[model samples]
Target: MPRTLVIGAGVAGLATAALLAREGHEVTVLEKGTRTGGRAGVLERNGFQFDTGPSWYLMPSVFEHFYNLLGTTTQEQLTLVDLDPAYRVYSEPEPGSAAPHPVDLPRGADRVRQLFEELEPGSGPALDRYIASAKRTTDIAERRFLYNPFKRLNNLAVPEVLAAGPELARLLLTSLERYVERRFSHPVLRQILGYPAVFLGTRPQDAPAMYHLMSALDLDDGVRYPLGGFWEVLASFRRLAEEAGAQIITGAEVTEIVTAPARRRRLGRGPRRVATGVRWRDEHGVVHAEQADHVVSAADLHHTETALLGEADRSYPESWWEKVTSGPGAVLVMLGVRGELPELAHHSLFFTRDWTANFESIFGAHPSVPTPASSYVCRASASEPGLAPEDHENLFVLVPVPADVSLGHGGAEGQGDPAVEQVAQAAIEQIGQWAGIDDFEDRIVLRETIGPADFAGDYNSWRGSVLGQAHTLRQSAMFRPQNTSAKVSGLYYAGGTVAPGIGVPMCLISAELVLKHMRRDYSAGPLRTEPQRTARQSTGSRADGAGD
Candidate 1:
């Protein structure tokens, strides 16, 4: 069979392996981490379970569609329960105000409109129009933009793109902040509408107005939480991939990609180099090599290109990455409190009145400076009963910071660093006051923090960025990294860094895009039955090919 080696066991890697294996290709996945999930990993400590990353499950249809492709339903795999209040937003009190303003974003569109009307009279109708426009953007994106790989200019000439050209142009030209300002008069309402930009790791003013579709998806479709945690979704993907006959090896860090010169006489005018397999080291520090017909990198795109493939085999130059605008990194604090926090919901956002200062701090000129102006808190125990001890809560707090800030590798100085501690203290104090928990710090029995430097060590994230490249107008769609390698044949990439951009839904779509490109470029033929040969054996006894 045509053996394929996939790097990383993240959502994209697992999904790609599963889909390719189902297509009759022998697939094997290599994961550097000890667990299957990359950022969506689960952590258990002191009887409290926490999701390390991706707490908000915004797009349900995406997960449903993935499960459906595997001949099953998301309902069959995991029990997905809608968070009733969706989320709660707490704004810092205005001058002369007695307390902070807390807005509960309830499920259902009519109820959301009611809430908007309460905030600003006559805003209900405006919200209706805004959501309608957002829905149109979503429709156009799903039908025309998201599904296609955008590998060539001709891909933009489709009928759907032609039909939505005018609306798309308007959305592309406008900024999300500008759109929200034009649609809503109230500042709080504008913040609520524009806050979804952070999910894409960009400021509202910098992100395209088309992202307002996120608000429609959030308020109309509602947010969901898989029973147990977000980790359950990773488990489901792992199970599905394994069932599809794909082998996954955890704690196997890939050192280099193995490639050989293509047989020019047999395949005319193909690339000079073709990927043969990969060389990786296991947890025990033992080295091993696996041979395959094709290789897919679902790991960090920058690491895969520069670190594994080296400068000579890279399609993008060092200057290209320098120009890429990466998304914000984060400072995450996981707390296991001894008492309940009834004021907090399944998800909550603590926003400061000075949104501009906060955004600038995150995406500013001097990124290394720490800013703890806003925070996102996820009290998963509010919805899931077994997540924490009785009468206690599991709190996951994240502060968006500039990707350039350092917290020492693996958070070596996280506990004692003055800057990191300052941010954590600010977040804790704000959340405690907002939730009416006066003794919040004392209630914490266990605490863990992850900073940008930790993200670098753990996930090899570029500049410790939590998300991949920002979805700026220039960094989006066809402008993003291509799925196929330009310098080497049979080498492909799939992840947040490539086309379709960031988020779990995008990762799944990225895998499909890679598969589509692979089929188109290599031609859909039956798997070759010849046994895989070592790179040394195939390359005329070149023993040097054995090591990276």
Candidate 2:
């Protein structure tokens, strides 16, 4: 069997290990963190459990399809429940209103259409047309784009792709904000359609209109949640990877990717090298080196390229990163409230009236953290009651800020740096005011905050970016970083930073792309062959290559 070493224990990392192990490879996964789940981790405090990342679980079909590839079913691994009112949108107070205006977006297509019609009379038809286009674009992306390895330009020029050439070009050329504003005059609706761009690590004005397909996932298909949390989902991935005959070692911090001493020179592209193994340090301050035929890094691409590999072996260097646009850093406030938050739903979005200025403050020429910032609140206990104590609620708040670590990291309340604490306090106040909660601050039994500096220290994130490179038109699709290293053979990348794009579904597709490219299969669709399944042995050890 081919010996393979997979770096990181993130969704993409575990998924890649599972896929490769199933293909008869002797796979071993190395994670820097003590536990599984990179960003989608869990924090337990006073009987309350908080999901530290990836609050919303969108795109059910993608999850289902990936499960099927593992010879399992989504229903078998997860108990998914669709959220009734998909979400509620809360906007900053209008001209004379004392409180913020709230719009409830219910589940189902017809109800969404009706809500649009009610918001802007005679908008039902326009919404229907827009939704149709969104659905078409989403379908096209799944069929001919998301799963593509981009190894062959011919694979992208298929009949279905050629048929939508004009439309595709138009969407690619336009901005998501421009596309939404052109169709909808309602500020709330436009914000609703455009805010998905934030999840892509770019403002709607910077993201290509092709991302409008995100609306189809939330509005048309409806929002759904796993009963437990994303941590549970990660556990499922770990289970699959272990069952597929892969070994996972936690607290193993990879220091360097060792390559052969000599590089073969190419005629014009300069010297090329081949990966030999990796040097890593375990938790107890011990160092060891392991050899493998192949290495796949699922850590932050910038960290993998700059920190792990040498300058000559890097595909994206420090200078290359300087030219790239980073996604917004964020201040994550996890609050364990004393009582139920009846006013807030499972998911709520707080949008500032001056939307453009808000985005500009973060991504423009001069960046500063915005006051009265637009934020997202996820009440996980609303869906999974077991997450909190009997009468309390769990609140996970996200505030987008510039990716500057100078703002500082996070800690327990009043313990973090001044800038980080100030932002967290402001977000709490904003949520209380906008959501119409009178005693919001008083009810906080527990509080924790994570800032850009925390992301940098914990994940070795570049620019302290919460997401990878922003999904600006210049940074997306073929323009984004490819999975393989140009300078080193047998080295590859799989994560939000590389192809297909960010989000859980995209990460899963990225893992598949690594397999596809490794096997030299570049078909622009999900793999169809039965995954080679070998006999399994579940093992995870802190010691190098040792099974427990």
Candidate 3:
């Protein structure tokens, strides 16, 4: 069996190891931290288990597909609980209004349509039109672009894709902000449609209208949570990888990817790329070298290219990143609250009225944390009470800021670096005001803040970006970095930084892309795996990433 060494034990890395191991390759995964899950890590404190990363579970079919590929099923591995009133959108107070406008997003398409119609009179038809367009774009993206390896242009020349040329062109050419504004007049509705851009690592104004597909997932599909938070999902991945006979070792920090010069396969071609092994330091700080026929770096793409490989073997060096745009950094505040935050829903979004100001504060020339930053709050205890002690809540607040580690690192309670504390405190205040949690701060029994610097220190994140690269038209789809290196033939990559883009589903698809590249199976769509078992009935109550 050919030996494979996968760097990092993030979702993508574990998925790749499991898939490759099933193909008879001897896979060994190296994780820098003491535990797996990479960005989807857990924080346990005083009987509360907080999911510090990637809390929202958006795509169920995608997870199901992955489990099927692993000779299992989502039902067999996961207990998914549908979250009613999927999420509540907390918008800034209306003129003369004493409180903020909180819209509880309902489940199913018709109710969602009705909610929008209620919000903006005579908007039901326009909302339907938008959903149709989103569905079309989503269909095209899933069938053609998301899984396409870009090995051949002909791969995407299917009849439906050919038919969508004009519509697709229009979507790609326009901005998400323009797309929403053309259809909806309500400011909150626009914010709802535009916010997904942040998840993609760009402002809505800069993100291509093609991403309107996110609405298809957000509204139509509704949101759900895995029983134990995202940590449960990570546990599933690790379990599958182990069951497939892949070895995973934590605290094995890789020093360098070993490589050497090699002769070209054809006389006309340049020197053939090669990665023979890797040099790493184990938990004991002892350096060891291990040989592998293939090396997959699932760490941050920029770190893999610039830090691990030699200058001679670098496919994307420092000069290349000078032109690359990083996504926003973030200050994540994890709190174990004393009481049931009845005012807050399972998921709440505090959207500022000045949406452009918030986006500019993160993406503009002089990026800084907005005074009343638009943020996301996930109260896991709302759905999974087991995550926290009885009568308490496991909550996390994410405030997007500039991708700069200089803002400082995180620490326990009132001890965080001043800048990070400023951001986190402001978010806490904003949440209390917008969500109507009168004594939000006083209820906090535990507090831990994660800032941009922590991402750099823990994950070697380039520019301390929480997500990977910004998903501008220039950095998305085929425009993003490919899975394999142009300079190192056997060195592959799998993570949020490469295509098909950020988020958990994208990372799972990225793992499959590596499988496609290795086996030369460059089909346009995801490979079909026979159904292992039909998903059973619901039991309860859902990014590959650096520090989600």
Candidate 4:
């Protein structure tokens, strides 16, 4: 059996360690913070609890696979309750308009269709058609497109994947805005259908059309919350990981990576020099070191290379680093209230008054403070009262902003106590106006704030970015950081910044891919003199290949 060391105990790191241990590898998960979830950490204050990140559970099938792999089912670990009337959108009635109407986006298809029918008689059928098309695209993408380990565009040699090429191209060019405009006449419906991409760190205009599939996920699967909030989901993972005999060590920061020189033999030439062995620092100032047959780093790629690999290392080129680096950071607010918010649904979106201008401010013009921008306020506990104490509520409010490429207010500086307070007050006020609660401030009995800077300080998220790289087509799939580092022989990557892209499901899939590779390599035994065939060579045609 080989010894394995996994850096970072976030979802990806934990999942990696758990799977490896279950495979009988002596695995150790070292986390910098005192907790395991990192950004998914929970905040508890005055008998109220809040899930700080990933409030909604959309692609539950992914979580189910993870649980089943570990010998437990989703039904046993946590209860996923479907939220009806998923969310409400409060559009500031059109300028100088007499009517005051807010959009109530229901959870399932039948209700959503009825809601659309109420807006425009024929729109219900259009929505159904739109969902059907979206589902078809998602099927291809999930079953085919996403499975390309992303070695290169040519890696997808499967027939079904190639056959779905036109679908991908169509989905790519079709903007959610234009698609929604073609289907719905109501401004609110258009905004609702076009809004989910905000989490992607780009406006709907820049977001690829394929992202509409994400919207379809919400509409088809419906928004769900675990009985104890998203934190409970993490708790379930922690329990399962521990049950699998994985050692989880929190408050263990890896300060340095130690290595030894070795020789690399060429195909026709003599041995070439190379450095090997993995080493890092523990939570205490003192250093600790261990040798491993393999290592997996779920942390930021840049940090892994520069800090761990050091200078003069020739693992990846500068061009690859430039392409897979950090993206936008976010400013988030968590609140606990005295009484329940009656009007607010499980989720709410307040679109910026000027969508185009908002993008300009975040990406182009830049801002000095947290400005009025598109925001998502999620009350997971609102739908599942079991998460909060009697008569109390838990809420998480988030706003995405540019990364701290500069020492700016909206990025790292936004995590400061003063900035957090200002942003919190502003967000509470904005939510009050949107919810039409005149005295909403009076209901707040508890409040806590987190921002991109917190991601940097607590989680070591490069540039304080929560979502890793931007989700543009250029930054996706094989274009994303590879699961296995070509530079470091035993090194691998899993999580938001790597292949298969971000989100809970993607992270879980990434872990599975890593495990699959390990099992394949381990069962095959030592390497042969001849280089193993690439994923492309191994699978000759598209029809008989994996992921097709």
TM-score of candidate 2 to 2 decimals: 0.95
- Model 2 per-residue lDDT tens digits across residues 1-548: 99999999998999999999988899999998899888888999889999998989977788878877888756667767778788899999866777756899999999999999889888888888888999999999998888988888998878888999999999999999999899899888899989999999999999999999889988888898887889988899999999999999999999999988435565646336888999999999799999999999999999999999998898888888889999999999999999889788899999999989999999999999986689999998998889999999999999999999999989986689889999999988988888899899999989999989989988888878888899998898888998888888889899998997788889999999999888989888888845433213212311222111
Kindly list the per-residue Cα lDDT of model 4 for residues 448-480, writing each as its tens digit.
Answer: 677666777676677778777777767766566
> Residue 110, candidate 2: how far off, in angstroms?
0.5
Candidate 1 regions off by >4 Å?
95-97, 265-270, 368-372, 409-416, 521-548
What TM-score, over all chains together, does every model reach?
A: 0.92, 0.95, 0.96, 0.87
**With candidate 1 superimposed using the best TM-score fit, by how many Å does residue 184's alpha carbon deviate from the native?**
0.4
Off by over 4 Å in 3: 94-97, 535-548
Cα lDDT of candidate 2 equals 0.88
Model 1: per-residue Cα lDDT over 1-548, one tens digit each: 78999999998999899878877889999999989889888888878899989888866766766666666656566766778799999888656665565889998898999999998998888898899988888777765677676655565677777888898888999999998998788877888898888888899999999899998887888887777787988888898899999999999999999888876634466577989999999999999989999999998988888889867788876777988888998878888888778888899988888888888877877665444378899999998869998888999998888886465432322464566667777788888776667898888887777878878888889989999799989988777887889888999998898878899988887887777887783222112223334344443322231111
The TM-score obtained by model 4 is: 0.87
Prediction 4 global C-alpha lDDT: 0.69
Q: In model 1, what are the clashing residue pairs, if there are any? A: none
Please report how far candidate 1 places residue 410 from its true position, in Å: 6.3
lDDT of 3 by residue, 187-275 (tens): 88999889899899999999999999889886898888778788989999999899999999999999999997765666657536688
Q: What is the lDDT of candidate 1?
A: 0.82
Q: After superposition, how far is residue 148 of candidate 2 from its true place, in Å?
A: 0.9
Model 4: colliding residue pairs: 150-478, 157-542, 158-542, 159-542, 159-543
